[model samples]
Each structure stands twice: as C-alpha cells, then as structure tokens.
Target chain A: MSPAEIQQSQNNQLKFLDKPLQADATTDIIYMMCPMHLLTIEEQVREIKAGQVLSILTDYDGALDDIPAWCRKTGNEFLGIYEDTDHYKFYIRKKAPDNKQNV
Target chain B: MKTIYMDHVATNPLHPEVLDAMMPYFREIFGNPQSIYEPGIRAKEAVENARASTAALINAKPKEIIFTSSGAEANNFALKGIAYASRNKGTHIIVSKIEHHSVLNPARFLEKSGFAVTYVPVDKYGTVDPDDVKKAITKETILISVIHASPEIGTIQPVDEIGRIAAEKGIVFHVDAVASAGNIPVDVRSLNVDLLTFAAHQFYGPKGAGALYVKEGTRIVPLIYGGIQEGGRRAGTENVPAIVGMGKAAEIAKRDMQKRIEHVTPLRDRIIDSALKIDKVTLTGHPERRLPGHASFVVEYIEGEAMLLLLAGKGIYSASGSACSSKALKASPVLISIGIPAHLAQGSVVFTLGEGTTGEDIDYFNETFPQVIGRLREISPYAKGWEGAEDPTCTVKK
Candidate 1:
C-alpha cells in the first residue's frame, strides 16, 4: 500500500486521550515539521527502558497518523495522544528487549 | 604609515589561533555532519564541541544554542521566530528605539504583518528606561526585544531590568548582543533573557558564523527550514570551518574578556576625553555604562563621512555611526533617538578598540581625529551656524 493509504488506516485506529499521561521522558519539537517529529521520537525512545513512556510534542499534522503507524511497525505500544492548545502530545511506550522488532 | 584599525564593532580580524583551530575542518575532515561514516562522525563531533564552547561563552547549555550564518540572521531569526511562534498567544512586540537595523527592520516588518510593535524611547544617553518598558506592556504583548548595546552610539541598554519586567509579565525576551557579547561577560542566567543573538566576527572569529541562545523550553519557529541541522530550528549545512573558528574565538573571548576590557577601557577613555576637548564635540552614549572598547561622539559642524575619510587618509580606520548609516549617508536614527539634533547626528563617529589596540594607537587617533575635525569644519558649510536649519529635521542637506 502507498504511504497515504497506510496513514489513512492508521488515523482510523488512533487513540485520543482526554488528559495527559505520565511519561519517563519528554521532548518538545513544537514548530519543527516533517521527519523531525518521527526522528525525535525514535531518538528519545532509545533512551528510555522497556515499559517506560516517551512523550513527543509536535505541531505537525502528519504526526497524528505517522507516529501511531510507527509504533505499530516497531511493535511498541501506541499510547493515546493528548490534544493541547496549539499542538499534540504523542505518547509511546518502549517495547521489551525481546518484543522489539526491527523497522 | 602604520595602519590602525578602530572599527572592531564592524568586524574584528580573525585571531590566528582561531584560524589554526578551523584549518582541519576545511580540508581533510570535510564531511556532512549528518552522515554516519568516519569523516562525518568526526565532523559531527567537531560541531558539537563547537556548540558546547559557544554555549559556555554565554553560560548556557549546549542544546540551547542554535547556530546561524551571521548576527543579523540570528537577530532576524529571534524576532521572526518568536513573533510567529507566539502569535497565537499574543500579537504585540516591544523594542527599544536605539536598536540595530537588524532588530529595527524586523520589528518594522512584523508591524506590516499585522503585529503591533511599540518602539520605546531612550534617554539622552541612549539608555532605555526599564520603567518605560514596564509601562509599555499590554495584555497583547508577547515579546520584548532590545539591543544590549548600540553599535552606533555606544550606549548599553538596561536589558537586565527589562528582562525582569518581561519575566514578571511572562513575556518572551530577546536581546541583540552582537555589539556587547564577547567584549563583555554575558551570562544568560543572570541576564534573565530567553533569547540572545551574537556573532563570531565581532569576537575575532571568521565571518558567517553566529548563534542565538534560546532558553530550553522556549518554542521558536524555524527561520530557515530545510533539514534537521541546528536541531531543526535553524536548518542549513553548517559552515564547519566558521563554526569551529567561532568556538575557538568564544573560548578565547571567555578566557580573555576581563583582560581585554582592562586593556581597551583606558584607550577608549582617552579617545573620548581627547575628542570632548574639541569645541562642539559631544560624547554620545552613557559615560560609564557603555561598552569597554566603544567611544562615540558627534562633532557639531562636520559630517561623519568627511571625518572618516580624512581619518582614513591618516592611516586610522574608524567608523561613522553604524555601517548602515555610514553607507547610506543618513543621520543615524540611534543618534536622533538619543536627542542629538539631526545635523549633529550626521557627525556621528564611532571608534571601537580591541585586544590589538595599543596606547600608541589611541595617541595617534586622538592627535589625528581633532585635526580631521578642524579641516572638515574649515570647509563645512554649517561651520558658521545652523541658523537656517535649527529645526531637528532629519534630512542631511536640508
């Protein structure tokens, strides 16, 4: 499938949270567009242990679909996103050592 | 004849040590910082090291510093970045009247873009009253930018007090420190600034390198958007050699700032004192609360360019107000802002000393400057009086 089709399917399955969840680490990439949101998530996730949550803040609309799809592809838990005033907070739980899959 | 360079504020000659530090990056270790190979890894390491050293100069964390191409670029980025980033929060911005063109032009640009900009006034000494800044704050105010020191008039603004007021109001504060940083000790923590702009060339580093200190957690929109360079804030291929030179220069500036101040202050004072002895020559900016190496004045009947030309002939290179005002042949707005008459503003002359400046250079400058003024005034049409043009008009020929 094309990237747009995959994003469409991923958007349908996105979980929205009413409130912010606890995260072991947080990286604010607000106003940074495109691949930065995804690249930052991958870089920040590696620093946290399995079952630890990494929160990414971004203003990019593409992250609404890309992050969740990224979690699905990498076998990590895609936690719900909390919508803020001007941006979104995406939470991802790092997978256990054995459960982690190569992208 | 021996040449003496007194235009340090315009740009400093690159220190030999800085050039030596930057040499390897231009040739053998030339690699894109984003690559994962050996050359690239070395390049990345060098860039990070430079970032750390640059950050250390201002007592900021490495992650908070974003490299730009020049001080003007950094200033533009700070103003436009913060203005755009906080537009949703508020649309009001405040800047001092004596700011550099980089700051003033950006503020003017923002004004045209539906943002409200309040240009706060300065005193006769070109000092911005913190009280005036406090009074200008409105509910819509989201950012306050002020120059740390005026390159034209040599006046240092009370940015710490303004920073306090901004902090109390929860407004983002940015300072254009292109003229002050590296010459003076700048501590971001003590200054209470959210963003500060400075350049490498001002501190004996190569041109085409500058940095903006964005306090951690401050959200700013990208000024140049292309890659993830500079942490996606300022994206362009890093000028590795220039950045390395900047790092070395910053390290040296931090190490030798106090000694430099001690070295140049006396010579600068000598220039000011000698110039003030001439009839109709008035010192500009605060007498004591100014940059250590900076001395500026307005000579009553002569034009700054004529003085600059005559002085250049004597093998003494100096500046006539800021580079913009000098090239444009206009009375500096900074001089006018400080209550100098428009005719007098045309006579604005600025001399900035550096580590290389000696007592003998000051002696030569002091002797030649008064002679230059006398010769210009001898031929000046305004020498007799401004009887017909006594009004504070801005036109030079009027």
Candidate 2:
C-alpha cells in the first residue's frame, strides 16, 4: 500500500482504539495523551494536586529523561509505564497529603 | 466531504481538459519525438504545439522555449548555464534574499564553484527595491536573477522596473516566474527578461514538466549533454504526456487568466480580512502586490506545528513555514530575512488557494482558525505578556 493509504489505516486504528470518556463522580482519574515535554512543571503539579490520578500516553522518542525528572520534581507516584508500537502509556497516582509539601 | 486542498503553490491538481489532451500520448500514441515513424511525427507535432503554447503564455517565440523535468531543473539550467557561458565576462551574479530554494540553491552551487553572488535584501513586506538591484550591479556582474513572486510569502517583485535597471547595465536578467505564471500575466517583451523559468505544476498542470524561456539571441550553455532534444538545449527523450498537458494548461490559463484571478482574489481577501481581525496576527509580504490566492500570516506566541496539528484535526489542511523547509529546525529564511522575529516566524502559516477554491472554503478556514489559534495560545507560556502587544513586526505595514 501507498504511504497515504498506510497513514489512513493507522488513523483509523487509532480512532478505533480511542474509547469514549464518561464523566463519573466516583472515579478521580484523568487521562491525557500528549508529548511529555509539552507539559510545564507547574501544569503537571496543578493536575496532580486536583485530587485525581493522571494517566499520560507519550511517545518514547525522548521520554526517558523527561518523565522521570517530572516525577522526582513533583513527588507524585510513578506507578509504571509500558511501551506500545510507537507510543508509551504511563500510570501515575496522586501523592498522599504527607507527600504534598512544596519542593 | 471532499478534501479542501489549499496548497496550490506546492502543486496543483491536473486540469481535466489538460489530462484529456495528454491521455493518448501515454498509451497507444507513445513514440519518441525524434524518431522517423508516423507516431514519432505526431509526437513531434504535439511537442512543437506545446512549445508554441508555452511561448505564447510568456509572449516569447516558440524557438526560445526549452522544456525541463521541473522548475528546479530549469532554474539549475538557467543559473548554471549562464554562469558557465558568461564566466569570462564576469563571475558575479545578483539575486534577491527571498528566492525559492530552486534559485537560491543553484546560485549557492555556482558560488561554491568560484562564482561571486550578492543577495539583495528586501523590506519587511518582502519587496525588493529596484534601486538596490541597480546599486548591487558592478562591472563584474554577469546575471541578475530574481523571483517574479515568492512562493512562500507571495510578494510580487517589481520585475519590470528591475528589468529596466538590468537593461541599462547590460546585465542578463532572469526571472523565476514559477509562482506567478498562471495567476498573473507575464509578457517577456514587456518585462525585458533575458531568461525566465516556469513550472507547469504551479498552474493546475501535471508535475514533472516545466519550460524555460530563453529570449532569442541569448547565448547560454546546456546543462545536459546527450541526444539532440529541446533544440539540442536539453537532451533525453521528451516526457510526451506531461508536455502535452502543460501545453493545454497554458492555453487554458492564457484564455481564462482574468476570470481565475477575479474568482480567487476575493477568497484570498476574505481569508486575509478574517485573519487580520484576530489579535497579534501579522500578514507577511506586500498586500496589494501579492498573488491573488496567496495568504500568509504569523500568529504570534503559538508554535506553527501545533497550529498545523489543530487545523488538521478540524479537516482544514494548511502548511506551516517550518514544516515546508526540508530538515531545517530554523524558521523560514524568507520570513527571517524580511525582519520578522524568530518567535513570530515560528507561528507562520502559508495558504495558497487554487482554481477550485470557493468562498465557503475561506469561510470554513476563518471560522475554524481563530478558535484553534486561541486555544493553542492559551496553553502557551510565550503568550502571557503578548496579549494586545502590537509589535511593529506583528503586521505588514506596507
């Protein structure tokens, strides 16, 4: 297939895998898929302090240096990360009240 | 919904009539134009007819036309050919700072080969002053090459005035008319150009075909050396089908030039007007003298790649200046040369409309663009202090 055809197929596959979101009061988890470096330190801290777990999906191209540094700076729990074909999914939990001191 | 293609300056879709004229040559009528067979004679006649059509588009004689594979090749031939042919006369050549890579790269190559080149600077609106051209000319200047219209910013150069200056100095004037050929009238006699290059794909014709108009009696060497094709100027078998299509497209453009200009200019204006209404946005290049369907702007504080992605999500296709350059992390040199700051230049986008573009497409862009820019800017740290800051570089003040 042509490059354009392959791009279309990949876009279709991405759309199929992107499940719809439901706003539930019982759960405190928010998901975001963007470049890890795009988020500033302040923005990442604000999201963690909102009493919600944040799951971030990022491409692995240069995330090794950024994600770990972000976790250390914010003192948020870095559950783990898994690599997919061209992207990686990272799970992070909100810090307990004792771990929320400003660094 | 059908895709809205606004990237005509990149390449145009083949005109249906031009394709109809070329279909036969690709199949049963395939023959080398130089052969002695009947099919060969037919192919030769078609090529000659195309030559005439291309020549007429620029008001040049048919014999003066030399077909090439692309605009880059034609530009290479024009610059290298003139530099080699006139090496003894002078080795210095003059060109504008904002020329397309086709002209710029060839000139740079000549520079590396021991030729001296001077790049004339343009104003913030990308207008190359004729006085600068005259002042840059020295006794050792052999050629003065400039773009008729910039492909990226759409500023139409004052070719006629520059032509007069070149004439007084006896310097050979070459205009890269690849961006302006179909949208505007290009009269070689009136422009006084010694050589001109044009690509068919810029005018709703097929890609891989272009023509260089070398005014009669102008002495220039050929870039290729093999068979005696293109009046022994360019060698190798002709691309018959593409040449035929280019010819037909030229004919149609010659006949319908005014109507196409009228149709596209309003769409261009509507898009520009909408863009201007937004805060901290700047239009690049000359306003009144630009191409009819060209609209380029810099939306300050937001990254161009992010804007491009947002527009792509909305099914609105456009191009960022940074994306167009090959492997260059720097912002567009054309934008930078015209005094736009690097931060603002990073937000630049170029939109080129074509024959099929409509008012609805412009409306869609206007409605969708402002919201996207606003969203991207909100997330940007650079945007904090830039609210309502109307820097001199934020708008084209021509």
Candidate 3:
C-alpha cells in the first residue's frame, strides 16, 4: 500500500471504547494514560482494598518502566497491556480477596 | 494512528529537496573537500556555497560563518573561545536563566573554569528585561550569551535590546538561534550579535551540520584543532553531504520563511485555542511575543508524561516538559523560572508546528485531546472532587 493508504487504514482502526465499563462501590477500576498515573498508587490501593481493580492506558515510550514497578509495589495484579501506534491500554486487578480477607 | 509530527524544535525530518541536493556529494562527488584535486575543488566549492547560503539566511557574510558538528559544539566554541580570547578583559559572563542546555551547559563549564557567571532571570512571560541585562553587566563581564527563543517554552527573548546593551558595553554577545532560525526572521546585523549558533536539523536540514555566525572582526579561537577547515576557525574534515543539505535548506528557508511563518502561526494559535477551551489549562510563555510555530500549555492535575503517552497513542507526536528534563527530575527550569508552579510544570506539553503541518492535523488534535484529557482526569486522584469545587476554571465537564 501507498503511504497515504497505510495512514488511512491506521486512522480507521483507532475507534474509541464502545462502552465504558461501570464501577460499582465495591468493584472499581482506575483508567489512566501515563506512567505518572502510577504516582497515585496509595489512592489506587485504597480503592483496590475496597475491592476495586485499576486499569490504565499509557504511552509505550516511558510506561514500560513505571507501570510494572507500580504493580510490583502495590501488589496489584497487572492484567495486561495493549499498544497501538502511540497509545496503550492497561488493565490491573485488585489484590483484595473475598470476605475471609476482608474480615 | 496516522502520525502527526509536531515536535519541530527537537528536530525536523530532512526535506526531500535538501536530501536530493546532498546525494551527489555522498556517492559521486565523494572526494574530501580539503584535498587538492579537481574533484576535491568541486567539493570545496559546494561547501563554500553552502556556507554562503547559511550566511544569507542569517544576514552574515560567508567569511563570517563557521560550520560545526552541532549547535552544542557551536555554543561551546562561542563561549569558551571568547572567554579564553578575552580573559584578560574579564572572566564574568552573563546569560539568561531560560537558555537551552547547549548554552547553559557551556556556561556551567565556563563557571567551573573560574569564570563567574550571572544568570539573569526572566519574567512570567519568559522574557529577560534589557535593564536587568544592563545591570548585570560589570567591567569584568566579557560575554552575554542568551537564547533567541527557548526550545521548551518557545518564548522569544528581547535579543535586539540585549544586543544593543552588549554592544554599548563592548562585551561580546552571542545568541543561540537554534530554535528561532528558519522559523522566524533573524538578521545578525539587526540583532547586533557578535556570535550566533543554529543547527540544520531544526530547519529540515540534515543533522550533524550547523553554523556559527561570527560578526566581522570578532576575535575568537578555534574550538577544534586539526586540519585547516571552516576558514581555520573550526578544524576537521567537513561532512560535505550534510553541509550541502544545510545550505539548500537555508536557501529554501530564506525564500519561504515569511510564507512558512504565515502557514504555521494560525495552526499554533488554533492548538492553543483548543487547549485553552479545556478547563485548568494555562498557556505558558509570552502570549504575543512568542515563536509563531510554538504552542505550550500546562494542564493542571494531569501528569504530562501520561498525556504525552495518550497523545502519542492517538498518533499525535509532541513533547512533555517533564520528560524533556527527565534527568533533572525537577520541572523544566524555563517553566519554573517563568513562575509556573512545579505541579503545573509537570503537566506542561509543548507542540511545535513545522512546514508540513496541516489544518487537518490541527483539527484532529483539537477533537481528540479534550476527550483524552477528560478520560485521564477521571482516573486521577488529584482530579477527583476537582470538578465541583469553587475552582470552576480548573475542571472540564465531559
């Protein structure tokens, strides 16, 4: 394909999230776009202990260093990361278990 | 995912015309410009012609232009050469706080060598006052090096006024015009600069090629010493191909500068306008007296790195103030010097437009940025409860 055709195809691929998932009081997820988003680890942990999962979309450039470190420190289960041209999609599951751990 | 390059200040892709002009030198005309043969003489002529082209773009004589490997090397040559040559007159040098690392790092190197350096502060708009510059000057002050326009903030300094002051004092004045050259009109004579440095890659020329304009009769020593090249001011074999490209790029810039300025200015303003519509977004640097192709803003409560990532993901390539100064960990000294709070400085993004930028690119950024910022803010702890506070200006509704 020509450069213009390649660009057109790339643009056509970047659709927004069709429907954002809902966050109940007990089940929450934090979605963010950068490694600096991991700076709010304490707040994210607070929500996670209350049975929340945090998902972050980050740029691939610097995020490679920050997000895994955040998950390691916070004990949050890093779900996965997906990267498109310039942006990223990240998902993390909360560490907190059910009633036994809560009690 | 169509990439839109908006980081012209960092570097520019080589222009096709410039690349074409440079091709023969690399392959067919591969003789060293310094040799004595006919092919070498032809290569030498190409280098001289390139020198003249670079000189014409900045209103300097061809004889006054010295080609260098990079802007940093040119700056080092200007600072250390003048300091060493004129050390009998003085050891004190004056520079603005908002200078690029190329200028500032060299000043620091001079300071370590027992040269007393005075850093003049800038106002909230990132402009240094001429009066302050004059006041900073003393009998021992030998050189006043300032940046023509900051690469990070895009604020154009009052170099003409500062140059006038330096001239009256008979002190050597140098301006790092790497960020301003080709993007804006720069006449070394009008600015009364004794020395000026600019890089080729910043203006769609090849990298590893730049020029330093040394005003006629300015006394300076060579930064490099080896074979006689660059009029014996800079020594070493010339990168003939890159120099040819730089020369061609300069010719094009000289012809099309006004039109290029007209084309990029509105795109810059549009980006700024779109950014301002989002709540808590503060435009950094001088509003009117700034680089026409530069737009920078600090988005409160959002991390700049994250925003850059999101923007990059969207195929919008730009820079964050935080990442640019990643080694320092401190926010950009330019942003901090201009009185932008550290937190806000961490959230600053710089978008620099160039010749190839289009209205479609601007429209895409305008449409997508707000949504990304809104989405990111929703997950930020600092951004929580920010929406309904008395600080209505700080929050953007989805």
Candidate 4:
C-alpha cells in the first residue's frame, strides 16, 4: 500500500480500537499514535479495561515496555506485539481470573 | 558538569560580555532612563548607545530602532501595529504558513478584527516561492511578513527577493529575524524591508529583550500607550539592563559574524552528515541554504518526545517536534506543509549549534543516539512488524 494509504488503514484500525469496547469481546484493538513520553503511566493505565483482550496500536515509543509492565503489574497477559508497515499493533489479554482469549 | 546544548534557536545563554555590560545598570548605573539626573542621563546615553549598536548590526539608523520586551512582543508590535495604522489604506495582509507563533498568532488575531489575511504556503523544503507571493497580493494588501529563518526546520526564506517584491508593490514588509540575526548576516538595507523583528535571547543576550527596526517613512500605531518613550512609538520604562545587554550582543554578533559562521557551519554539517547514515532518517530543511548552526530531521518509527527525552538523558539538550503552543503535541504545521505524512512529522528533531558546541559533543551524540534508538525501537509498536515496510519517503524537495 502507499504510505498515505497505509496511514489511512492504520487510522481506520485505530478508530476500531477506540470504539466502545467490551471485555467480553474476543479481541478489540486501538491504534494510539500519541507518544507515550507525552503520557503518564496513569494515563496508560486508564486506557485499559480489566478483562478485555485488547490490541493497542501505537507508534515506536516507550509504550512497548510500558504496556507490558502494566500487564505484568495488573496480572494481565501481554499477547506479544505485531508490526505492519508504519505502526505497531500490541495485543494483550486484560487481567481477569477467567480471561483466556488470545490471538 | 558538562551539558551539550543544541537548542540555541529557542534561546541563547547570556554571553559573559553581555552580562558584564549589564551589571553596572543594576548597580552603579541604576537610574530611570527618563530622569534628568546624572545617573539617568548616563542611563539614557547607554540606552541610546545600545540602540545605535543594535541599529548598526542590521544596517539601520539609531532613529529606526525601538526596543521591546521580547521577540514575540516585537512581532506583535510590527504586525498589529501596522494592521491598525494602515487599515484605512488596506485591510489585507499576507504571511507565510511556516511563520513563528508570534507572527501566526497576531495574524490570527487580525483575522478576527475585520482584517483579511492570506497564509502563503511553502514548499517541501519549507521555502516560500516569490512568484506565489507576487500572486497573493491584492490592491488592498497593505503588508507582508515572512520569517527570515524557520527554527523548526532550519529553512532560510529568500528575504531579499521577497523584499524586492514588496518594494515594487508598495506594501510594507516585515521579516522576523529572531532565528537568523546573530548566526548570519542580516542587512536591512540590502533586504529592502520596511520593518524587521529580532530577539536578544536568540543571540546570547538576556531574555525579555528584543528590538524592532522601523524604516523612517513607514507609519505604525503603537501597541502600548503611556508616557513618552521610544519616540512615542513604544511606551514603558526602558528595560535598561536587558537593552544594554542586547546592544552588546548585537555588537559582538556583528564583529564575529563571519568567524562564528565559519566555526559553526562545519560542526552543523558534520552532525547532519553523520546522522543521515542511520536508516530511514531524512533531513527536513534545505541542504545548501540552511543556517550555519541549524540542522533538523525526521526519523521513521519514532516520535520526537521519546527521542528528545533519550537525548536529554545523555546530557544533550535539543528540541523535538513543533507545537503551536506548549499544550499541543500534534504534528507540526511546518512539517505537514513540507508534505511529510502527518504521522512522520511527529518524529522531527531540531539541533541548533552555537559558540561552545564542539566536535567531541557531536561525536558523543552520534555514538549514543543510535543505541537509544535501538533500545526504544525494540519496544516500539511501529518497528515491531515494520520489516519490509514501504518507503516512508514522500515527494519532498531534497
């Protein structure tokens, strides 16, 4: 895809990520173009749901380490990170005793 | 403690000579410049002498210089003052898209005041086309203001050519030289500009110090109203110490203009040449025409704040990205204007070298930066699956 087209698709995926999400859904995703350095961990924590399997897409930044550490602290499982042309798609299974969905 | 400062475009540390010149104004030379007393006379003479020195640096006469609180303030005075005074002549003004916030904000304010403004666009190298400028002028267009140099991208505008166009059209022209004044030679007469703006702190003078040069015949309404000061053009108690320091800074700049350019240009080139060896990093400004001490670039798969923070941790100081105000981290207008994808624009970093910058400093940065990038990229969502991604380069002027 063209770079602009790639960005558009990335943005479309990000829009999908920000939807009114549910923890019961199999997997929901978000593309966060905002830099983690500009954000506090508290801000990052607030973006998560307790029992959701989420894929948060962000650019190259501290969020890679930060999100995993947040997952570790809250007992969530980081499903590992995936990359496309210009963005990173991070997958995580939110912390819940009964949460098991991963992709 | 050794700290490498590469953010000189934002502000210059006060030169020791400037400080030495200013010290007496705070102590033995303390006097209200308006008073008739000996101390006051001396103070007034100092202020006038400083005005002469500042005027000399820009090839303006002493009568043309009006001291102000800062470059931003000088910009406001030039734009708004001209707008209000020339409203009867015309309500139209033109400025470029890549001007500093000071110029952009005042233009915006004018828009709300029944004045019409056309924002001229720049090319991929952050340059305004003189032909585009000539095309934008209307019969009602009374003024045109363009920046001499863009701090975010280190792009120097064609000021002399733009000045020629303005002179032919009989429109008042203003150049914001805050970014170019000390690091390069800016001769007002040669540029043929009617008004110009500059800040002291951009050239190793104190903060809250700036100057506006108004040509003899051009009329502008005063931005401030009060007792007689600055020939009834700008009103306030003269900032004696800061103004004196600016004068000293101007004199030093004029004296060392060639020498300093020779010293800083090579260092700037070395940094740019070394940094570009990294993958997917593109230089943002004009390669040949940029300021002597200025360099800028946008790196793929990274954001500016992260890069800046990492660089800072290594004892290097610089700026990342451009925001209109401190609150916004949105993609920079300058970068976007240059046709970089909005997402890629966030990766912008600006490095402005100055007097104390050294080769060893650039070496340390060159060595440390890639490691930090590697560390950050390893965890980056963008880089995670970025193997074999399409070329991020857009149709930018190289």
**Which candidate ranks first by TM-score, i.e. highest?**
1
Q: Please, what are the lDDT tens digits per residue for candidate 4 over residues B1-398?
A: 46799998888889999999999999999999989999999999999999999999999999899999988899999999999867878999999988888998899999999999999999989999998999999999999999999998888999899999999999999999999987789999999999999989988999988999999867677788665678657888999999999999999999988988998999999889988988888999899889999989998887788988888888989898455311376667788788887677767888889988988998887887778778778777788544654443323211
- Model 4 spans with C-alpha error above 4 angstroms: A1-103, B325-327, B384-398
Q: Candidate 4 — which pairs collide?
A: A17-A29, A17-A30, A83-B385, A88-B381, A88-B382
TM-score, per-candidate, Cα-based: 0.95, 0.76, 0.76, 0.76
Stretches of candidate 1 off by over 4 Å are A1-12, B390-392, B395-398
lDDT, candidate 1, equals 0.89
Error of 1 at B52 (Å): 0.4
Candidate 4 chain A, which ten residues in sequence have the lowest lDDT sum? A25-34
**Tens digit per residue, CA lDDT, model 1, A4-57:** 546544644689999999989999999998889888888888888998988999
Give a tens-digit lDDT track for model 3, residues A1-103.
6775444334333234433333332111122223234544444456554445555544334555565555555545454555544455555556555422321
What's the residue-level lDDT of B168 in candidate 2?
86
Residue B303 CA displacement from its true place in model 1, Å: 0.7
- What class would a CAPRI assessor give candidate 1's docking? medium
Residue B354, model 3: lDDT of 93
State the local distance difference test value for candidate 3: 0.80
Query: DockQ values for all predictions?
Result: 0.71, 0.00, 0.01, 0.01
lDDT of 2 by residue, A1-103 (tens): 6775444333322111233222111111111122323343335545455445555544434554555556655665444555545445554445566654552
